[model samples]
Structure formats: C-alpha cells, structure tokens
Target: MTVAIVGAGAAGAAIAYALRDADADVTVFEKSRGVCGRAATRRKEGCRYDYGANYVKDDDERVTRLLTEELDTNGLVEVEEPVWTFDSAGEISPGRDSDERKWTYEDGITQLAKRLFAATDATVQRETRVETVAREEGRWSLADAADTVLGSFDTVVLTPPAPQTAELLAAMAWDDDRRVAAHDAVAAVDYASVFTAVLHYPFTLDRSWYALIDTDGEHPVGWLAREELKPGHVPEGESLLVAQMGHDWSGDRIDDDRDQVLREAVGHVAELLDDDRFAAPDWTDRQGWRYALPDGGVTGDAHRSTEDAGLYFAGDWVAGEARVHAALRNGFAVGERIVEARNAKTY
Candidate 1:
C-alpha cells in the first residue's frame, strides 16, 4: 500500500521506517527544507544555531539505544548549572543534584531527524505544502499549493500538530466529526512560545549550559546555553549562548521591533552575570513557533478513520507534553495500530 506520512519529524520518520521493511510503500511530506520539525537547526555564517530543541533524554532503554549512536557520553553533557528562579518577591534556586542526563545533537538537534529519515525509503518532499486532501474511491488525493496533483494513496498519516491537522481537515470538510473531535482533543493543551538568541563569544564559560535569572523582565529569559560545550557545535576559544525568552514576552513582542528584541535579550544576559564586558553576538535573529511546545500534551483518540480504512493519524501533540520520547511513543502507537488494521483486513 502507498502510505503518505505528512511530516518528517520523529513520529513521521519512525512510521516510515517501521513500514519500510513491512509490506507498504511510504512517502513523507515535509513542509520545511528538511526534517527536524521542533528539533530544528539553522546555519548562519560559519555557525549552526539550534533554535529549536536543545537536547533530548529518555528513560526508555530502546529509544536511548536508538539515539545514542554515532556519539559518546562525552558528546552529551550533564547540565550542572543551578537554575535560579526570580519572582516579584525575591529569588529561588531549584538546583539539579541528581544524575540527570540531557542529550544534545553532537552536531545540532537536526541530526536526530536526519538519522531517522535516512533509515527509510520515504521520499521527503521539502517546501511542498499540502493545500488540500480529499477521499475518492477509497483512496486519498492530496494537492499542493501550485495546483499540481500530488497523486492518490491508500493511507494518509498526519504527524503535524493536532491543530494544523484539524485545520486542513476542517477546511476541506473532509471529516466533520473527526475534525471537530480532533479540535476538542487539541484544545486541551496550551503551547508556549519561545524566542532564542545565539551569541558567539571569544571564550567559553566552562559550563555546558548556564542558568539565567528569570526575573520580571519583559519576556524574562530562561536558561542561557553555552553551545560550545556540545561536541562539534563550536570551535575552541569560542562560546555560543542560547537565551530563551519566556512565552508571555514572546507573545507580547511577537512583532516588536527586531532591534528591541535583540537588545532586550542582551540586556537580560548582562544583568544575569552583572558584567558589561561580555560582548553581544556579531549575529542575532529570532523565530516564532505557533505551537512551539505544549503546555501539556494529552493523548487524543487515535483509531480508524471515520471515512476510510487503513488511514491513521499520529503526532507528538498526543502526549500532552513535548519531548523526543513523546514523539517516539506516539510513532510506536501508530505503527502498532497500522499493523493491527492490516492484520484484521488479511483475516
């Protein structure tokens, strides 16, 4: 069967890879230039910025095994920075003292998706946005923005956010009940918006990540990551700091003057260290994720389609929380369901 995976992230890639050796053909459609949806990366000048997920960790042994390849323990660093929290009252330090492990992309977060995408025969079409989808004669017809007929397939698997999936299905009125039900399920979670600033410095901070003071600043900054500590992320004697602006500030200043955002970020870092000598980055930019991450991820109903057989829907959003493991778990569930449906049909 020709199965279409509507994303190239962890869940989509996992589905494709699982079905690769199975009795099915997989075709993955990615809206971006490459995989790594939330775990994305950007290249600017000579440096690569991990604006999305900085790291991933899992207690699941199988997943840990899958992601731990091609790198060593030295490739992943333990975050020892004592996180300091500040409110209008005063300050609080919730330190991390356990053996907590946060895994980063030895190169950048994009490597995770790249590795997964490479495992399957799935055709990843970048910059190809699905404009519409419809069902005809038990097959799915998907069209792109240019009015080109993308072709028909037996199964359509969507791995984008629940809201986005619902929007397309709603716009097409494809499955009114399923669409409405999907929205109800998706509305359960709130997504936080984050803005990051990548700063290149002349020296390293000797720490993999730094805990910044999250005070009452207009989009108070979260952790300040020294990217140089991540293997292959930076050169010697150079530092890369990634600062995260809180959701409230990001929402308020979503369209604020670009200069204002950068300046505010730099100032926050300066205040955190009480230093003026720390040079502002020679490069600065920002990105907005409409559904950057779920305030909480809740499992929605993942079952047979209301209109067609063998069709399935899965995504990280189902987990009611955001993380690499959540995507992996969701993909596994999707695979299990597909197998069950296929087996039932054969009987």
Candidate 2:
C-alpha cells in the first residue's frame, strides 16, 4: 500500500514513524520548512528556546515510552523545577497539577519529530503545500497551489488544523457526500489566538520555578517561562524569557505593528515580574498564532463521515485535547486504523 500524509507536524510524523516497518510506501508533505508545527523552537545568539509549547508532560504512558525508549536520541531530558501559578495581581502559588516529569530536548522540542522522521523510510517533502485532495478509482491524489499533481496513494492522512483541512476538502471536485460532511464538520473547529514574545537579557535571572501561568485569566500575560532554566538553552550569565499574551489581548493586537506590540509586551512583562529591567531586553522576538489552541474537537458523527473512505485525520484537536501527548495518541490510533484498512484491502 502507498500512503501520503499532509502536514509533517507531530501527528503526521508519529504516523510515519509507526509505519516505518510496515510494507508500505509513505510520503509526507509539509508546507513549512520545519516540523512539529506549534511545538516549535527558535535559536538566537547561542540560545535555543521553545517559543511555542514550553514542554511535554508525561501524562500518557505510551508517549512516555516513545520519548524515553523508542525515540531516545540522547537529547531527552527531564525538567527538575515545578511549574508555579499566579493571578493577575502577581501573587504566585503552587500549581495544582500532578508532579509528573516535564520533558524537552537539548536542541529543541522539534527534535521529537525529527527523530521520529529519521527512524522512518518515508520521504518528507518540505515546503510542499497541498491545496486539494481528489479521489479517483478508490485512490487519492494531492494537488498543489499551481494545480500540479503531487502523487496518488492508497490512503491519505491529513494532520493540519481543522479549518485548513476543511478548506482542502471543500476544494475537491468530487461530489461525494462524505467529502461535504467532512468539510462541514472540520470547518466548525474553533481555535484561540496567542501572541508570544521572546526576550533575552545579558544578566542572570534567579527564579525558583521554571514557569508561571496566570490561573485567574485576568492578566494581560497568560504565561511566562524562563527558558534559561532548561539546560543548554541559554549561555551562562544570560537570561531568556518567553511571555505569551492572553487570548483577548492576543486577538486584539495580533495585527498591530511589530514594534508597538513588542513595546507593550515588554511593559506587561516588567509589571508582572516586578522587575523594571524586563522592559529593556538585550534582544527580542515575537510570533502571533491565530489558531494556537483548539476550543473543542469535532463531533464523532463528523469523524465517522471519512473513516470508511480511507481518509484519516490526526492532531491534538482530534483527541479533544490541546496537548502534545494527545496528538501523539491520535497519531498512533490513526496509524493503526490505516494499517488495518490496508491489510483488509490485500485480502
């Protein structure tokens, strides 16, 4: 069987890794140059920090095994500090979550996808944006922006966000009811906006916890994490902070001027941290995510619409959770389902 996967993010990469030993030809297409999507990292001035997802939690044993045993490339390390929470008033307190170990790579979180892809024989084509998918004679073919046919496959898995997937399916010329239903169901997936700012200082910052979260939902800043706490992320005598704006604030200023946003974000961070020096970082960077987190997962009725057609969907939202672990779980389940379907076709 030949398989083609769109979006080489966590879910897509995990699916490809699972099928590495299976007797199938797999090809992955990624629109961006990097992998792991929102679980992204940035490197600057000898500092490597995660600007998107801070770290991965070991909430699922399967994911834990994959990180520690299966995909272990000597870069997986545990975070020793606890995550603290605070309100808009800057009153810090202990977090309510379990004492599970937090995980990250010495290089970056994107290493997870890189390692997974490396373990597979799949051909990953970067910078390939699949515009539409058409089904013909029980096979699926992908087309790019210029209407060029990428490839035809026995199975196609989509791992992009729900809205993007809906757009792709809606563009198909086929008149199958399953396609229309999938488009409608996926189109309804809602997401939250997030604006992140990465700041670097030449001096050291002494903080007890690795990160702080605004639990009351009343602060302009939703989260603030010290990237230097992660080993090898920051050079000695230097500090890096990743500050994320709240949903309302992010949505309001997402399109604002970059300088204006950065100035306001630094001010907000300074006030939140009770340090005037935070207002003036040695270097700074920013990113705005329109679909940072999914509000809710698509209903199962919608998921069932494409199952019989050998069209599978996997992502953090597919499992009704906005965590890295959920995406891995969804990928594993979808890969297994696809393998089963392929075997049935051979018989």
> Distance (Å) between predicted and true CA of 43, model 1?
2.7
Model 2 agreement with the true structure over 182-281: per-residue lDDT tens digits? 7888888898889999999999998888788999887989999998888878999999999988888888888889778888989999998889998899
Residue 207 error, candidate 1, Å = 5.2
The list of candidate 2 runs beyond 4 A from truth reads: none
At residue 108, give the lDDT of candidate 2. 89
Looking at model 2, the pairs that clash are none
Model 2, 220: alpha-carbon shift in Å? 1.0
Q: What is the Cα root-mean-square deviation between model 1 and the actual structure?
A: 3.4
Model 1, 1-347: lDDT tens digits are 77888888878877776676667777888888878788877776566657777676665565676666522433444444443455433343454334546666656777777777687677888888887778777678888888787878877887787667766666652555665565566555566767777777776575323454455544366556666656666777876777777778776676777667878878877666556745466666666666777776645453333424545766667655587767876786787667666656641
The C-alpha TM-scores of every prediction are: 0.86, 0.97
Find the candidate with the highest TM-score and give its number: 2
Off by over 4 Å in 1: 69-94, 173-176, 206-219, 298-308
Candidate 1 has an lDDT of 0.67
Q: Give each prediction's root-mean-square deviation over alpha carbons.
A: 3.4, 1.3
Question: 2, model 2: CA deviation in Å?
Answer: 1.1
